[model samples]
Target: MTGFPGVRPRRLRALPALRDMVAETSVEARRLILPVFVGEGFTEPRPIASMPGVVQHTLDSLKRTAAEAAGAGLAGVMVFGLPETKDATGSQALAEDGVLTTALREVRAEVGDDCLVMSDVCLDEFTDHGHCGVLTESGVVDNDATLELYGEMAVLHAEAGAHVVGPSGMMDGQVGVIRSALDRAGHHDTVILAYAAKYASAFYGPFREAVNSSLQGDRRTYQQDNRNLRDALREIRLDVEEGADIIMVKPALAYLDVIAAARAICDVPIAAYNISGEYAMVEAAAANGWIDRDGAIDETLTSIRRAGADSILTYWALEYARRGATR
Candidate 1:
């Protein structure tokens, strides 16, 4: 019989309280941001088919849900608008009374200072083509044209009472332009959350449906490639230089490496989105009794926090908050 000389790691793992005491990371309720979809022209909340227990909230529903998010102690709620109409240039995105603007105002008013109201400052949900920006005559996305629109959109969101604006379009110089636009419009306090390393992943399928996206094709041209870690860091660095208050990596579960790597190099707070497909897969498996639903949700969120995300945007935020409150 032989015994190892090293200290036994099993001592810490033997008890739940000991494991909790020595845990490297924790998912606090205040660091989880709930992502909500507000649908225009809808009198009632519509349940999204692919995302179980999630709904496309109407104006009234959105207000109530956002209030719940505040009451549950979430750090913030991210609003995504599902407009009833769309056009080539997504003119509605900049309209004062646009669906998103309206929702943002209402939610901000309801949540007040209890929770941060963040808006998705992108045009995919408002454009007929479902691309993030305007198209050129050759049907390619116009980067410069898109940046102009993004700036306009940021001001609109600020005027609508959004505390933070997230530029998820992946357009070059988007964060800088948005920051400049906000300052010029007297929204100097508005924060910019840059989608720094958003990858063009296949896991966005459920999200497309969530926004009623009309994306005829992929956004691979603009979104970062999944295989390139160095490129992701480069994107993060550029966004930092351009004045990103907080940088983000999309599809958190698949890119924990990118999230951890960003945490190592970047000084700003890091955020990660637990996207729709990630939520749906766990729900599907749990529905069939393949895994414990509650446990899966907690584990996934804990893993993201463990990977060094300062905050997490997830569909499970409200539920997790409620559970934490009860516990």
Candidate 2:
């Protein structure tokens, strides 16, 4: 054979320094957001069986962890609360003394602008039925009514010192309602992180346990179908139009294409969740000697960034940050 017609690219990949210099995508600790689950009425951290190395943090543990996150230079920490009591309407969600609201205040105070303090604005963790919103007399989730509660919840989170509020319930017009609520409440600077194309995926199994879910049926009625790309883009566009500061796609690994697609038509920053099941699978495999944990973790995060996610919500954010992301 003879002279090649194209340039040889292996030279660029010949050394780590060469590869780093030419790398098109990089994962940084500052672009990774750690998702934290804070439990009410617990004196000690409880390990989550489904998620290895993750735990339900008590209030004290939660503040310590938030400080750790800030010290690690993480982009932010997202808070999910586990309440001791539940109800049909999830009244605790709006209570000033509620678990989540309290955690938000503590976390924000602990971090103190060092890292963003974000809160999950949904009723699932607080509702008795385990649905994301209140149900009708017929036992179906009321979309319009849910929007009203979401509006209130967003304001509460903002008032509690949340820099960003994520509405993951997938209720129609949720972003708009929450935006209006925040503006009216005089918290106009609070950012709205829309769970724009959150798919109703089975990968959420571990997450259900993490939050002690009381899901009655399923969220397919509200969460987007995994089979439809058009549906994802539609939701993303609508959220952007409705004042979503940043739009997100859930279950990042399986929906990298959707994440890339969302980036294509979006003018705002894009975020993707490296959800629980994805984390568990890798952890399980590593425990069983199936894969290198750090390697898998780095690859998983890098792939999301490569797919155009401006930031990633992940269980491994702190671990990855501590070990140093592949930057």
Quote the RMSD, in angstroms, for model 1. 1.5
Worst 10 residues of 2 by lDDT: 1-10
**Residue 94 lDDT in model 1?**
86
Model 1, 1-327: lDDT tens per residue? 357756677999999999999998888889999999999999999999999999999999999999999998999999999888999999989889989999999998998989999999999999999999999999889999999999999998888899999999999999998998889889989999999999999899999889999998899999999889999999999999999999999989999999999999999999999999999999999999999999999899999999999999999999999998776
Query: All candidates' lDDT scores?
Result: 0.94, 0.94
CA error at residue 57 for candidate 2, angstroms:
0.3
Off by over 4 Å in 2: 1-6, 325-327
TM-score of 2: 0.98
Model 1 ranges with Cα > 4 A deviation? 1-6
Q: How do the residues 1-327 of candidate 2 rate in per-residue lDDT, one tens digit apiece?
A: 468856787999999999999999999889999999999999989999999999999999999999999999999999999999999999999999999999999999888999999999999999999999999999989999999999999998998999999999999999999999999999989999999999999999999999999888898889999899998899999999999999999989999999999888999999999999999999999999999988999899999999999999999999889888344
Cα-based lDDT at residue 167, candidate 2: 98
